[model samples]
Target chain A: MQLTGGQMVCESLIREGVEVIFGIPGGAILPLYQTLPEYPKLRHILTRHEQGASHAADGYARATGRPGVAFATSGPGATNLVTGITTAFMDSVPMVIVTGQVGRSAIGSDAFQETDITGITLPITKHNYLVMTAEEIPAVINEAFHIASTGRPGPVLVDIPKDVFEEMGEFEYPEKMDLPGYKPTVHGHPNQIRKAAKLIEESERPVILAGHGVIISKAYDELMELAEKAQIPVVTTFLGIGSFPDDHFLSVGMPGMHGAAYASLAIDQADLLIALGMRFDDRITGDTSKFAVNSKKIHIDIDPSEIGKNIPVDVPIVGDLKLVLKVLNERVKPTTRVDWVQHVEDLKRDHPLMHERDTDELLPQHIIQQLSELTDGRAIIVTGVGQHQMWAAQHYTFKEQCSLISSGGAGTMGFEVPAAMGAQVGRPDKVVWSIAGDGGFQMTMSELATLAENKIPVKFAIMNNGFLGMVRQWQQIFYEKSYVATGYSRNPDFVKLADAFGIYGARVTEKSQVKSAILKAMEHDGPALIDFVVEQEENVYPMIPSATSVASMIEEPKPEEIRQ
Target chain B: MTTTESPKHTITALVEDKPGVLNRVSSMFRRRGYNIASLAVGHSEIANLSRMTFVVEGDESTVEQVTKNLHKLVDVIKVSDVSIQNCVSRELALVRVRANVQTRSEIMQIVDIFRANIVDVAPDSLMIEVTGDEDKVDSLQNLLRSFGVLEVMRTGTIAMDRGLGDEQTDKDNSSSTHRMESGL
Candidate 1:
């Protein structure tokens, strides 16, 4: 059937089973917006900003196992999506970005709203296309969706010229793609699996270091089985928080900077580190030379390049995590390391994650604990990067796969609000919470209006420390406490800001009010914000300083010593 | 850990002949912090595909990582570290030298010794074309430098596996031919 390029886009999206897209309509994309009404089943969310649209799409993609779609016009509209695109790329989220460019004749003339989005996004995207003609719309759309959703998924952009969107063409969606150069290996080689199994069987101190790959590959069950059958401890990376049941006996919580001290100690003492679906990023591996120095490593991932990209591995298996774990689970035998388990328990007992309860000031950790308790540890917790992010990662007990969605690799601030909106929209049945530090919250607090506009009942918790808490912590520890620009002399009244957005708001200055504020936000039935005024100088403990090994973690000072 | 001297490596890739494929491949190298000494891209044997050859200076681990990263790109069909393989390599350089009537014969003699051709001639300059490995081209350029070489343009390094049967041809027949026939 013959259809205009804009119509072809809608048709192809329907074919790809995309039910909703987040974007704003502008001059170049007016044709698409005009055609959008024809397809009543496809929902178009009008975000206040292009960045919010991109991040909402990303959140939707992460919450659900489907590729999220975002749309924008050219130039500034396209550039605004760069941070979200890089975030999806860094975390390997499946997303398709559509941008409308200037007319073909005026593309190189630097016409209004004309940007080389394809060129700008080249390095970050898995693949991108610039459509010059309407005839190529259907095929390009099909390819964009295919590339974005398959083989270690990431973002893909399709920039359509405005003229082409108005032109007519024969619309034909191919049933299957014939991408010869883009095949991903989905099964592990038997020989390599066996070698990894042998390493698992022979080692007495085996530890399974899981990462976001575990959630991406949907191998949570397999991961649990492998950890259980081998009787090995499991420690999750920051993004891998929900991959394993936190309350399980084998679970050792998170490990790295701001990770549990026991988890870091366990990794340091392990003889075999079976890294699954996670890169040994610098945050997880404090000092590369000293990171699991004695452990023989087994790294498995879908992307072959990630196998040896960081620390050297003795057995490298390149394939899907679920498939590799299934094979390894069958080959490996049930074993127990009673002494190793004892040592881990002792470490946890000696170094418990705690704050000074005697202090009258409201604590961030206390607020998180109350929020987690109020939500029954089941809310989808999303966070902006900083001290609050680390506090949430340490405090929240995530038991659901993909329940905690934070910007890991990019460490993007202001990611919490819109991402929570996306997550709430994707999973309406579940409660979604956006936790941000004072510094990070102000970055995108405008999204509170987005929440009220969309009526997305995502709860918000802003840790009001009155300073850039993480940077201040670093300055205090690394420098001579030169406060510099870390401290904010004044800040906006968050409750008033929320109230101005027509959302329920409250402020909690005392620890006694933390629980009630969280419960009130949860019961609001609409978006609500709770500003918890936390201690300003408080720091995240068990920090492995830069260039130092995990063994050199700095813990909280003793109460008696602090008094002196 | 054992350390080795970083050396120049000739790498070749077969990629789908599509818009922005070159940009995608080049950007991958740049993003990964790999220094590309030279790069050349052109049509290959099959339609809708192009062959890219580039020289990179790196150690064994860096080269391994470069190849692995190149393979990860969706447009790249095949990546080969031709430097390590038993292969035939060549680079073409067009050199313009300051040669007058007096030094013209001397420059020609030196070019002839390297089996090069003087493609263009003028009153004050001569354009010489030399095709060989990097070292061979380097030697001729060195001898011509005494005559004051004005300009040099090199088509990096292009290579093919050396054997009775071409590995790329065999691999392409099994995997890439069907896609080309499908016209995707």
Candidate 2:
């Protein structure tokens, strides 16, 4: 059937299983907007800002593992999507961004509302396509989803020229994509797999380093089996929380700049390291030369380029995490090395990971633990970066991989709320908790409309510390507490902000009310935010200060010493 | 095996074949880090697929990596560990030599011994095409140095097994079987 380019977009999206689109209408995208009402199943969210729309789409994708779709007009509309797109790219989330453009003729002429959206987003997106005709729109959208969700799994953009949307053409979507040059490696090389197994068998102490790739590839079961079979302890990177159950005997929890000291110590002591689906980012491997010095590393990842790019590997297996782990699990023997396991247990005991709040005020860590208890591991908790993010990372014990999908590498501030939106899209049946600090929540507060429009019941736990908590903590530790722009005066009542968007909200000032507020928000049928007026000065502790000398660590001084 | 010093090197292979063959052949190379030193593919014996010769460099470990990976690509019909296997590895180079009366005779005499053909003869320039192993190519170019060679276009090393006939089929080398046999 022949349809206008704009109508083709809405129809193609429906075909791709896209039910909700978060965007703001503009002149360039008026053609697409005209056909939205016709598709009753397609829900279009009118966001306060184009940035908010893009983030909502990002949140949706992150939550569900389905490609999230966002719409925007040309020029400024496209520009606003850049931050959210970059965030998605950094975190490796799949998204199909549809943006309206000026006609092909006015592209280089610098016409009004005409911006080079493709060129501007070239570095961030995995791949982008410009649809010159209506016939290409369906195929392009199909290809975009396939590319975005498969292989390395990153964001893909599709820019439609305004004139193309106005023209009529036959609609057809392909069942499969055929790109000759774009073949992703799926199976591991047999030799590399063998080498990894042999190394694990020979070593006295073997450790499994889990990362987000396990979640992305859905290899949690494989990861658990490998760890149990090899009789090795498992440690996760910051973004790798919930990759293995925290309650598992072998699971050592998160390890990195903010990781438990014992986890870092365990990494330092291992003889053979089996790194699964995790990139050894600089933050995770603080000093590369000193990281796992006694260990011969076996790095398994789907992206071939990432294998030897960071730390050199003795055995490198390039393939899907699930496939690779399955093979490794089959080859690995179920041998019990009681000594090595006991050693890790000893370290865990000596350097126990704990949180202590020596104050009468309600601490942020207390609130996070309370949420964890209240939800009973059934909720998906997302967090923005800063002291609060680290505090949650330290305190809230996650139960599954992808349950906590916060921005770890990019440390993007406004990640939690939007990512919560994405997580909710993925898991509509469960309670989605977006845990943010006062500073991070406000960064993308405009996304409240996205939740209101979709009626996605994501409860917001905003730890209102009245400052950029991480930066403020650094100031307190390094610069004698001479706070800068981190401090802000009394801000807008978040409850009112939520109310304005036609969503439920509450504010809690005292320690007694925090749990009740969270319970109330969780009970509400729709999207809600709870503004917890948390104590501002509490610091995320046991932090391994970014040291100049590897041997020394400047631990946080006692609160009494800081007063002097 | 008892040698205190044995420097390991790599062999370059040029093959005529189809697509999906790379995954099959590279799967033969046991190590994943077996770097493809330089693989230049172009038109060769067949028109549909083309020929590719990859130069891989490494120690003994790298050789294992190369052989194991080569067998992984579906389209690769065969892989030769030519570095150790007896094979005549050769390359072709076309040189545009500056031909003057003074040194032309000497250049021609040297070319005759190298078995080089003078494809083009101009009043002041002579274009010669030479094909040989690494040593022969190097010697011929060295002998042509006195004649003032102006330009040279050399195709990257393309190779085949030393003695070749329809002896081995692509199916004979099952990647899975070969990998299991190698105990990878």
Candidate 3:
């Protein structure tokens, strides 16, 4: 049957089981928008900006483990998706970005709204394509989804020329992809698995350093079983927060820069480090030479390149983490490291994560703790990057898998709101919260309209500190407190801004108002915003100075020295 | 493993003949802070597959990392470090140099010493084509420079292992199984 390129895109998405998409309409993408009414089953949520659409799709992907779909127009519309696309790319979130381009003839002629999106997004995407004909739409869409969701999932872009969207052609979606060079290894080598098991059995102080791969691979049960069977303590990376139950006896907590001091000390002291599905990012490994200096590392990652790219591994197993853990769980013998567990407990007690509450002013840490307590550590907490992000990671205890969704690799500011909306849309049953600092919230607060329009009940907690808190902290600690562009002299009344968007809003200035305001926001049927005016100059502690070894951590100052 | 000096490495990769594969490969090198000395790419024996050869200047670990990272790309089929292999390598260079009435004969004598061909000749300049190992091409380019070489374009090294008879053995050795077996 003959179909237009726009129809082919819709049909292919339907065939791929995509039920929802986030996009904004514009001149170049008018054809797709015109055909949208024909397919009522595929729901399109209109976002105020392309960046919001892209981030919402990313949040949806992270929540559902499916490739989220997003659409944008040519040139500026497509360029706006760059930040979101890079965020998804850095975090390995599966996303398919469909962008409209100028007509085939006008591509490089600099026609109206014409941009080389494929060229610009080349490095940021797992793969991308430029379609010149309508007949190629189905195949391109199929390939785009497949490539985006396959091994080491990431964002893929498919740019279609406007003429192709209007052209008529035969449409057929291939049942099987003919990508011979794109095979991903899913099974670990038996020898490597056996060697890793041997290492697990022999080691006395073994620690499982879990990363985003654990959640992506859905290896939570296997990870838990391995930890239980080997009696090994688990320390999660920033992105790996919810992979292991935080309340579990074997779970130590997050480890890295701004990680729990005890967790960092445990990683430093471990004799054997079993790294699962996580790249040793620089933030996690302060100084590569001194990171886990005493440990014999066993790295298991689906991407073979990540195994030893950062840190040399003693036993490198290249395959899917879930499959490898399943096999290793069966072969590995049950053992106990009583002394190691006790040592971790002792360290945790000595260097606990706590802030002084001697002042009457509201503290961000206390508010986050209240939220965690109110939600029983079960809500899907999405946070933008900054001081509040680190505070949330430190205070909000995540007990469920895939619960904490944040921009870990990219550390993108303004990610929380749209991402929280996507998460709420993806998982309507769960409680979703977007925690943001003052600076990051202002970056993409325009998405508050998208939430109100869609009636997506994503509660937002703005830790308003009146400064770019994280950078301010760095300047205060590293530099001579030259506050440059960090401070915002005049800030908008957040409550009034939220009310302007037709959503419930409240401002909590005193500590007494924090709990009631959060409760009120949680009870609201639709989107709500709570502005918690937190202490302005707070810093994340246990920071390993840049280019320094993890062993040399800057501990929190004496409580008497802290200014209220 | 403890080498202090950076060494030149010859890397060969098999990739799908798809759009942006070149950009993907080159951008990775640039983004990862690796230097590409020279690069050559052409269609391979197989259908829809292209072969890419590039020379990189890095230590042993960096070269190892480069090969592993190239393999991570979905478009890349296989990656091999041919620097340590018993292989026959060749590069093609086209050098355009000044060939005035006085220097024409002298240039011809030097070209003859290197067994190169004069592909194009103008009144003032001659373009010579030469194919050999990197050293041979480098020496020829150096000698041509004395004659005021106008421009030089060299195809980076394309290498293949010495006859393993089946020839496919090299491909098999470059497979993931071989990589796993070799503990790389």
Q: Indicate the worst ten consecutive residues by lDDT in candidate 3 chain A.
A: A555-564
Q: Identify the superior model by DockQ, candidate 1 or candidate 2.
A: 1
Alpha-carbon TM-score of each model against the true structure: 0.95, 0.77, 0.94
Could you tell me the C-alpha RMSD of candidate 2 in Å? 7.7
Candidate scoring better on lDDT of 2 and 3: 3
What is the per-candidate TM-score for chain B? Answer: 0.85, 0.63, 0.83
Which CAPRI category fits model 2? Answer: incorrect
Which clashing pairs does model 3 show? none
Instruction: Give the C-alpha miss distance for residue B154 in model 1, angstroms.
Output: 1.4
Lowest summed lDDT window (length 10), candidate 1 chain B: B175-184
Best by lDDT: 3
Full ranking by TM-score:
1, 3, 2
Tens-place lDDT digits, model 3, residues B1-184: 1112438878889999987789899989998999998899999999989999988998888898899778877789988777665455688999999999999999999889888999999999999999877878898899888889899988788876554433454355345224332331
**lDDT per residue (tens digit) for residues A467-529 in model 2:** 988899889878989998888798888888999999998988888887788888888999999
lDDT of each: 0.87, 0.77, 0.89
As for DockQ, the candidate ahead, 1 or 3, is: 1
Residue pairs of candidate 1 with colliding backbone atoms: none
